[model samples]
Each structure stands twice: as C-alpha cells, then as structure tokens.
Target: MTRVYTLVNQKGGVGKTTSAINLGAYLGVYGQRVLLVDLDPQANATSCLGIDKRSVRTGMYEVLIGAAPASPHILHNPRYKLSLLPSSPALAGAEVELIEVEHRETRLRDALAPVMDRYDYILIDCPPSLNILTVNGLVSALNGVLVPVQCEYLALEGLGQLTQTIQRVQKSLYRDLKLRGVILTMYDSRTRLSSDVVAEVRKYFPGQVFDSLIPRSVRLAEAPSYGQPISTYAPESHAAQAYDALAREVLVQDGIPTPAFETTR
Candidate 1:
C-alpha cells in the first residue's frame, strides 16, 4: 500500500518544501521507494532537486490539464534515490483553468492513480496558499497530511484556518483525510521562543507532533542551492539526523517495521 501524504501548511516560509525534499530522501534511504510531487507553482521543490523548471517541457501542470501523462513527467533524483513529479511556473495558471473543469478537485488524485503502486510513498509539496492546487494535493493524499510548522512568533497563526479547510475537505471530499502529524522545523534551542512554540504546539496537538524536531541549521538552508537534499549535501549535519529520525517515526506510525538508523556520516 502506498502512503501518500501532502506536506501542507497555508503559511509560507515554514519549511514545507525543505521537509518534503529531505523527508522523502530519508524515506528512500530507509529502503522505501518515494515519489515527491511538486504541486507548488513556485517550483522550488523541482529546482531544489536539480531539475531546471525552464527545461521541463512537461510537468504537473501538463498532467493536471490532461496535456501529458504522469509517467513522462516523473523524474528520478539520483542523489536521493527518489522520484519527482516536477512543477513549473505554468502551474500557476492551472488554478484558474481548472475552476470550470469537471471533477477538478480530484484531477491530481486521478492523475496519480496509475503510478500509485510503483512507489512505497508519495509526498506532495503544496503551495503556501490554500488554493485549488493545494486542494488537489489534499485530495490526492489518501493517507493524510504532514504539516511543517516553524518554531517562531506567529507560528500557529494560520493553523486554525488550515484545520478548518481540512475539515471541510474531509466532510465533502476525503473522509479518511487526517492530520498525520505536526513537524516542528527550524527549531533553535538557544532561543526561548522556539521552546515556547514547540511546547504550545505539543499542548495543542499532543500525540500528533513528531518526536523529532528539526533544528535550525545553515546546511538545511544551503542544501537547496546545491540541488541536493540534506542527506546528500550535509549528511553529518543535525538536520540530516533529525529527518532520518522522522522517517523512522513515519514508518512506525503506519505500522511498518522501522529499520535501524544508519548514520549518514
């Protein structure tokens, strides 16, 4: 069974793309075949994986509009040993184009159906805003959503609106849609604000928060510039270890046996 999860959060600059990329890489390191779907029009996830958006003739935009097949858009990230459904700037127009289309919300779900069994996990990196594209991501994720919340002031600001949106989707679209877990990212232990935010989020969600918190690291921020995941860019960094632990937690949550952690050092 493929575990499809949308890394969603309406708030921007919350490490959604970073988490999606590194988490999928670590999952692949743990021997799970992972597919990362870049649903954001910004195409950060696609470019972060070393794929040039300008050179991508076909991507999620083409697939969603029925102009191309999903398989052809799928690109392999050799460094991470994972697959990616690249996104391009043209995807921004898809929101308006899909508005009048029949079953627009499920277009992504339908597009991914043929390749669902080809990977052990399918992770979608959603845009910051809750738009039609984000809705498509939520609809395609049958398993649930993995939220990356940054540890800072106003960290929980838009979470309520996001939860309400998810509830609305669950009520009308996917009943099984769930809040898989909350991932605390860019946590700085030296700052009091970081600790307070983590405590508050844990108090709010309780067991829904993952045990592994991603620490603030320069390597994490720099990895994307090099078009590689933290596992490949700075394997010995704390960010890499945190994501590795996160991969184990994800498997354990799904009742899949977690393998022993192997240091990327």
Candidate 2:
C-alpha cells in the first residue's frame, strides 16, 4: 500500500518545497519507493532536483491534460530511490482548463490510481494556493497530508482556512484523508515568538504536529537555485541535518527499522 502525501500551504516562502524535496530524498535514501510530483507551476522542485525547467517539454501539465501519463514522465533521482514527475509553467493553464471537465477535482486522483501501488510513498508538491490543482491533490492522496507551517506569530491564522477545506473534502470527497502531521518550518529558536507560536500551535493541533521542526537556514534557500537538495547542496547545514531527522522520525513512526539514526522527537 502506498501512502500519498501532499506538502501544502496557502502561504508561500515558508520552506514548503524545501521540505518536500528533502523529505522525499531522505525517504528514498531510507529505502522507501518515493515519487515526488512537482505540481507547482514555478517548478522549484524540478529545478532543485537538477532538472532544467526549459528542457522539460512535458510533465505535470500533460499528466493533468491527459496528453501524457505520469509514469512515463517520471525521472529517477540518482542520490536516492525517489523519482520525480517534474512540472513546468504549462501547469498554470491547466488550472483553468481543468474547470471545464467533469469531476475535475478527481482528475489527478484518477490519473494516479493505476500507478499509486507502485511505490511505498508518493508526495505531491502542491502550489501555494487552494485551487483546483490543490483539490486534485487532496482527492488523490491516500491518507497523509503533510502541512508545513511557518514558525511565526500569524502562523496559525491561515491554518483554519486549510482545515476548513480539508473538512469540506472529507465530507464531500476523500473521507480517508488523514492529517498526517504539521511540520514547523523556518523555526528560529532564538525568537521568543517562535517558542510561543510552537506552544500555541501544539495547544491547538496537539498530536497532529510533527516532532521535527525545520530550522531556518540560508542553505535551504540556496539549494533550489542551484538545483540540489540541502543534503547534497549544503550537507553540513543545520537544515540538511533537520530534514534527515524528519525522514528518520517519519520512518520510525511507520514502524520501519532504520540502520542508526537518533530523531529529536
């Protein structure tokens, strides 16, 4: 059984793509068959994976348009057992076109069904919006939805909107959709507000929050520009180390035995 997760957040620049790329990479390194779908029109995940955006003639766009299949568009990552269904700018147009189709929200769900069982985990990198594309992702996933929340004062404010959307989806669509967990990103332990935000978020979300929090680091911001994950771009950076811990913790929670790694919990 494959567990599909979508890294989603209505707010941008909160390290959503960074978590998706690194988590997927580390999951792959940990021996899970992982597939990362770059659903963002910006194609940050594609570029961060060393994929030239311009050279991508077809990818998520075609998959959504029914012009090409996902499995065929997938490109394997050499450093990990993960694969990528890279996206391009063309995905922007698909959002509008998808509206005209029947069961538009289920298009991606239906497209991914035939190939879902092929991997242990499939992570969809949804764009920073609750649009049709995001709806497609939510409808397609099995049980997991990994939300990346920024560690800031107004962090929890926008979460309500996403939760409402999830509620609607559950009521009208995917009943099995699980709130896997929320990973705090750009956490600055130095900021007292960060501490307060965490405490407050935990107060509300409780068990829905992930144990691993991604710290803010310059390396994570630089990785996508250079087409590499933080682990490969700045292996010694704190962000890389944190994502490694995240991967370990995720696997541990799944009851998978890891060789030798201590998660921060």
Candidate 3:
C-alpha cells in the first residue's frame, strides 16, 4: 500500500519544505518509488529540485481546480529518482477559488486518488498556514502528518494551535488522522538552546518524536539555491546523513522493508 504523508507546519521557516524535499529524495534513493507533491504556493520544493516555477504553466492549481490531471503535470527528475507534482505561484489564488467548490477540503485527496497506487510513497509539501491548502494536505494524509520543528527560541510556539486543529480534524473530518512524528530540524550541536529545545519537544510529544536530529549545515542551506537535495548536493554532509537515517526510520516504523543507506550520486 502507498503511504501518503503530509509534511505540515503552520509556522514558516521550520524546515518543513526542506524536510519534504530531502526526505523524499532519500526515500527514492533507498529504492522506494516516491512522488513529492508541492502543494505550497511558494513552490520551494519545486525549485529546490531545479525546476523553474515561472516556466511551469500548469501546476498544483490546475490539478486542484480540476483543470488538469495530476499525472500530466508531474515532473520526473531522473537524477533524484523521484517525481514531483510541481507547484507555481498561481496556487496562491486556490485558497479563494476553492472556497465555493463542493467538498473543497477533499479536492487534493480526490485528485491524488488515481495515482495513489503508482508509487510506494506520496509526500505532500503543504503551505505554511492553516488555510484551505493546508487543510487539503491534512485531509489527504492517509498515513499521517510529519511536522518539522526548528530548534530555536520559539520552537514550541503555535504548536498548541496546530495540535488543536489536528484534534478538530480527528473529531469532525478524518477519524484515523494522527500525528506520525515530530522531526527536529536545524539543530546546532554547539548551542545549549538546541539541546533544550530537543528535550522540551520530546517531553511534549513523548515517543512521537523522530530520533533523527537534523544538524545545521552550510551545505544543507546552500543546496536549495543550486536546486538540489542535500543527498545529491552534499551527500557527505551531516544533514544528508541525518535525512538518510530519517528515511530508514520512517520505513521501519511503517513496517516497510529497510534498504541499505548507500551514497547518492
């Protein structure tokens, strides 16, 4: 069965998109068929994979509004061994356009239904807000939600609101909806604050936090500008290695076969 998970966080710059892009890359590297859905209007995930957002005439907006089928809009990146349903800036209008559409929250879930079984994993990179777009991503998360929290001063802020939203969805929308795990990103090993944030997050989520701690690395930050994942751009970097371990942990937790972590070309 395909594991459909959404990397969601209302707070911006929490390494949410970074996590989605690299995690999907590593999952693909490990021999799993992966499709990354760039649901964010900013299209960071699309550009991170070397795609030009402006050049994309039809993107997530078209698919969500029923203007086009998702498969035709998907961009296959052979280098990364992954497929991406690229998003463009036009997706920003979808929040308003989808307001009057029936079953608006489930549009993404319905849109992805046809291609669900084609891949082993489908990862949705949601926008950084609790609007219709994020709701759609949450609704389409068949497996669960993966939250990337930064290790900073305000790391725990707004999480309570997010938790409440999840609870509301669980009660009224998808009953099976649950938090898959919390990922701590941008960890500075040299900072005492980083250690404090990790302990605090763990205490808050208990065993629901992922064991992988994404270290802050210059290579990791520079990869997106070059339009590449950390695995390919800096495969030897600490950030890349952490994401590789994260991919394995996700596979193991989901009872999928774990593949040997090999160097990416």
Per-candidate local distance difference test: 0.93, 0.85, 0.92
Provide TM-scores for the models: 0.97, 0.95, 0.97
TM-score for candidate 1: 0.97
The number of clashing residue pairs in each candidate reads: 0, 0, 0
Name every residue pair that clashes in candidate 3: none
Arranged by lDDT, best first = 1, 3, 2
Give residue 6's error in model 1 in angstroms.
Answer: 0.3
Question: Model 2: residues >4 Å from true position, as ranges?
Answer: 262-265
Range of the 10 consecutive residues with the lowest summed lDDT in candidate 1: 256-265
Best by lDDT: 1
Runs of candidate 1 exceeding 4 Å displacement:
261-265
List model 3 lDDT by residue over 1-265, tens digit each: 8999999999999998899999999999888889999999999999988899999999899999989989888888889988999999999999999998999989999999999888999999988899999989988999999999999998999999999888887887788998999999999999999999999999999999999999988998899999999999999989999999999899888888774634331
Error of 1 at 46 (Å): 0.4
Q: Write the residue-wise lDDT of candidate 1 on 52-166 in tens digits.
A: 8988889999999888889977998666898999999999989999988999999999999999999999999999999999999998889899999999998999999999999
For candidate 2, write residues 49-147 as lDDT tens digits. Answer: 888887899899898888887777889877756789899988899999987888888878787888888888889998889999998888876767889
In model 3, the runs with Cα more than 4 Å from the true position are 259-265
The number of clashing residue pairs in model 1 is: 0
